[model samples]
Target: MAPAAAAAAQPAPPSLSLPPSQFARLQPHAYLLAHLSPPPSSNQPSIRANGRAPSQFRVTSANTGSLTHTNGSAVVRLGDTTAVCGVRAEILHTEDIASWSVSRPTPASSSPTGNKRRKLTDSTAKLSAESENKEEDGDDESQIQDFSLLVPNLSLSTGCAPGFIPGAPPSALAQSLSHQILTLLHSTRLVRAEDLRIWYQPPNLGPEELERHNENEQMDVDAPQGEVDLEKNKEIKAFWVLYIDIMIISLAGNPFDAAWAAVLAALRDTKLARAWWDVDNEMVVCSDAVSEARKLSLRGLPISSTFCVFEADAASGWRAVVIPDAEEEKELDDSTRKGIQRRWVLADPDGYEEGLSQERICVVVDKEQDGKGKTVIMKLEKNGGWAVDTKELKTLVDISAQRWEDLKQILEQC
Candidate 1:
């Protein structure tokens, strides 16, 4: 009896108190879910923990021509993540290339006929491929990748992220980003071959040289119409190589977007100095006058939007009710019984959100001017989870299209 009374008389222990910020850090997924679907009675807005809608992106800013020594430079900031890119132009003389050749390969000979049977076989497709190869040989888009004309390198500073060691070699993430950017540059063909080429016309052509050139042309009379002869009236002299270097000043999240934005901005701002072959000096000479500078004729501006899927683990027992209806509850009874998880799509995710979300999707799009502002998808990449279905993908594309408009405005203003 005395023991029972002592137990009953014990004062009630005080409930533990935890601050919201501390709770947020400890229970990131739960905190985000609460913010995404807030209870109606609380009168809280339906937004992410960072106070952004599911489709809302971070604020963006762009600056160009910041570096004096480089040919062009640009700085881009998306929310807290920032990246700077610098472009340096160098000349590569034609004579310096050891394996350079302008000669077109002759088409393969047909198989020897046996009783006139092989002579009747068709060779149109083979002929077409060989001739197209001959026509687009020298200055096709392949040159950009084959010769490595555009070199892009990305570096993450120690201060940019916590995992980056101070004196360590390039991280796998950095190397992967660099390769992705380079591949995109080549696939987009943003830079024109004509913009990088320098040519010279001889004062006169001798009879022997003219006759030889005429014979070469006569042999290729069956080539495609309107084919651009890379060395039509002038001889190739040199080519400009643009080396793009990107530095991550800060990394909040989505470094790829910021790095690519910086690259695009820098290329648009670039103005290569004019150069010509000096007959007397037998060398390439760059003009000092600013009037001779030329801006790159870039293709349509491509903007990228990234999204992450944040799935709440029902098995972890983290649930906060938000104004549930009886009918809806009954409808989801099977899924609830099955312990199926719920998810949210977060746009322009921050460092905190990135840690919680494993699945990610990035969409690159461009608004075609002549197509009445039609959105053309330049690239699409998604991995890590299967929560994003066709419906979710469509939603992401709409968000990306809107993002393109916003970025286009900022890019032009800069």
Candidate 2:
């Protein structure tokens, strides 16, 4: 036989020597396709690459009080995603509180009775002003925590992910996530407002006398100091402001859930340094004693659950079977089956799964019931192209409630 004829008769051997780097690059795509595609036998359910059920979440772990300088700190890991949160408290005066409150002008309304004589009292006008301010704030309505501020900031660094760059100004994604976190904290009212209030005590002497005494104390180190009267300054005039910072240590998708979890853990562990006004020194003093510090009054623990929505592929045998015309059905091959248009919800999607998902929903729920004794949905955020129905949203809420209990137990352990 001729060499060419012999080579043609023998089939080409399989290519089994692909380079590791090339395989690594193609592995994700291949894996995704495999999961989306149905099994040859048509008896298996379409499973995640990690073998988890569609609605199942990845393993989660949390640790608190990790940073020494921060008043409270926590690190949360959900699968490969990692978020660290730190909370620092500061003192805010009455003027500072007023500045944080939005300023707005009140509108004059026409009298119901034409030319009716009506006099507006000072209290009524003040109430009207506050109502106008609240209206102007709209969805970004600020919560008055004894007029204290709670600022939450999120940072995504280059080390966290491949796309992020170091030294870059805050990205749009970071800003949006920070805003959402702040909104959730405020709306949930997790930290009690009254807990932030710092009462003011009047100085033993008048303002002028107190100034002179302060000067004298500064001038003469050997001079005997007067005892501070803690009971005198009982008027509320200041507050403890909290500054919450969240850092993304790693990016593996579902950052919102991880960040919120870290925030909850950190805030739960926060303790404020004991502060008192020193009438003799004419200044506010914080105690260095750890025993003097007080724990923050946390209202309720709210946990967040996130889900990613992907379009279901009917051709993937896991979906509903399609009925073709009687004649065509018998002749149809596996590849010839067309995919149906449907959506699938995946809970706690990792980076790879998130990449293929189009829509995302984050639900924040608290175990506490409102005055009406119903579970509170602290926050419900949905973004992307797909829409969820009422029934689906209700199911998500139920899932969130379950997650809340699980997370609460974890936090309690921390």
Candidate 3:
């Protein structure tokens, strides 16, 4: 048999499938090698393809408190890549089946068991009393409502990514990124749901009764002016909804960094409206007379950091270029550049690096420690690459700890 014929007869190997984020990590290594091998032009020494010195970072500027009406807003820029985050607080209804409290009042019109109430009084009084109870029920039902933190509905229309189009469904990438940010927030318990519970003096009222009361109040509003049922529209007692919209305005390499930075900036400036519950009146109040806007409590800020690896030589057993400190990055020599790969770790990376990194590792850390004062929550592997040994992993943790402390100090001033 001819060699060509035999080779053609062989079955093709099965293709390997990896997550999209892994694809992003593998993207940079190939292109970065070409740029790294060539000596940087002396004329444009300051401009690296990645747009940062070996030890330097992309220019970072944060403009906070930008939205005039929003509770909080921020816009962050790293070079040409920019992210804007706005936090709008809205009161909504809570559907959580948990937290049913006994002893809470039911509307006089609502049945004791939460069913429809039958008229019991004489015919003439029945009509009068029924109308009155309907009014009362509408006034008292909303004891608590859900609060939502949403990304702008208009953002999708502005063309954030190639996959995103006006009036189109969210692509898989959009869903995944949104999930990531929400998971991170939930894992860290950054926003305490219980904290939102509006405590009332001499408290007591049942959920069923509250709804009935609200129903009655709706009937009383004058035909001309629609009435807002404060009880029915009360802000949720607990839990929060965070909708993150990451606009990939530029598919620059480090979406994680940009997304996280946007998240932090938005959170830093975020605030909520204050609400008070009056136990005596058995109702929630949200008005100028009893309510005021307040900032959300942000304790021990958390930061996510990323690093890019380049120019790897698998045959020679070269692992990666560790940009652990400033000195090493400053002393990058030809041998260092050729023999070892280069890694730029910081809050954000530009388009060049995003397109050409070998592998990327991102670590999230909190500023405060636990009983042992250890703030490191969890180390996540987003884009898969060379498996880091236990020792190297610890080094990553140590670096993250230091970075966390530094950022915490920076936030204090802000």
Candidate 4:
């Protein structure tokens, strides 16, 4: 055939045309890379497919006291992901707990201190303080964890995410989220045991009552009514167990952050009424007056920020300029090959970004209200890949610090 005829007979070049949404669903990694690493000749500003910067977080909104029936409730929305948390305070009578007395500290030799039945102050509070001191220090977690005072449960509703069957049991991700929340709760020591304790202070022994008490008491005491053993008389009859329930109404990604934020806001909004053990009724009684209630004094606020690293090769950095260094190309090996790959650190990744990235990092940072108020790292978790190193971790911490400040302001409005 003629040259022109032969050329005409050749097969036509293949071309594909897909809408942006369908392309993202099919080739999420490639789609993201195209936005993040556009060709240099195009002179386009590098941005994520969602029009966000590498470290940009989704819009966040928090609202507390939304559920009037619960003691405390908060609904947090992180972009498309939404989570609601409800904190219910239930009285846990000491009689119900088998190990309640086993862990109780014995009365000290010191003189009995004055007790306040109405307020939180009493000899039992002092004993609790002393008990906390007896610890190695900086570890204020003992009874709260030992007795399981804080109960946190996270549930993902049927429509929250794909593959979450309407009537199926809790998914592994749901279980993992619950574990993470519960772990953070105990690790941070956010709740104070004193806040949960319901104490009972017996009436002081008068001149005649002291003699009668000494005669009936098994242990002989020479001390008179001036300093009766108060620790022995003042007992923790019950505790307020916080049943923190987190429901994921919707999940686009970063469920942990939304869940934790809801937990924090709900706990901050929680208010427990003054409770005491009634000797006549032999049950815990809570005051009806709202003014008598007190908000929980949580520890320093810790905000969690999660980031994922997307690594791409020179060939598919969205087909952008990825010419390897001269030296790298010359000594191309396993190590050098990995070094040539591009990495993009995306913060607050949505469900799409999450599935495309293998390496993940989550930093939990806080600024304590006490003293100079410095930023502290409560937790640093990285897994799935080694793309994130020490320097990357430090950068994540800084990002988390900023996130903490932003969240603090959002929650303050609640």
Which candidate has the highest lDDT of all? 4
By TM-score: ranked, best first = 4, 1, 2, 3
For each candidate, give its TM-score against the true structure.
Answer: 0.79, 0.71, 0.57, 0.83
Which window of ten consecutive residues has the lowest lDDT sum in model 2?
108-117
Cα error of candidate 4 at position 8, Å: 21
Which regions in candidate 2 have their CA more than 4 angstroms from the true location? 1-12, 16-33, 95-148, 201-233, 313-341, 369-374
Query: Tens digit of lDDT per residue, candidate 2, span 304-406?
Result: 9999887655565554456656676667675444332245678898887788778899888786546653568888888896568779999999988878777
**Model 3 lDDT tens row, 1-414:** 699999999999988976545654665454444344444433233234454554344555667777676666766665565676666655432334243344243433233321222323478566766786665443322222212333332132245545455677766655676667766665555554433455433222454654576465434222111112332233334333344444545544556556667777777776665666554664555555324655566545677766654434555433345566878777887545554444333334565565545566677877445657666555566464664555655666666677666555544445
What ordering of candidates by lDDT runs from best to worst? 4, 1, 2, 3
TM-score winner, 1 or 2: 1
lDDT of each: 0.80, 0.73, 0.52, 0.83
Q: RMSDs, each prediction?
A: 8.3, 11.0, 17.6, 6.7
**Candidate 3: worst 10 consecutive residues by lDDT?**
220-229
Q: Count the backbone clashes (under 3 Å) in each candidate.
A: 0, 3, 30, 0
Clashing pairs in 2: 200-233, 201-233, 202-233
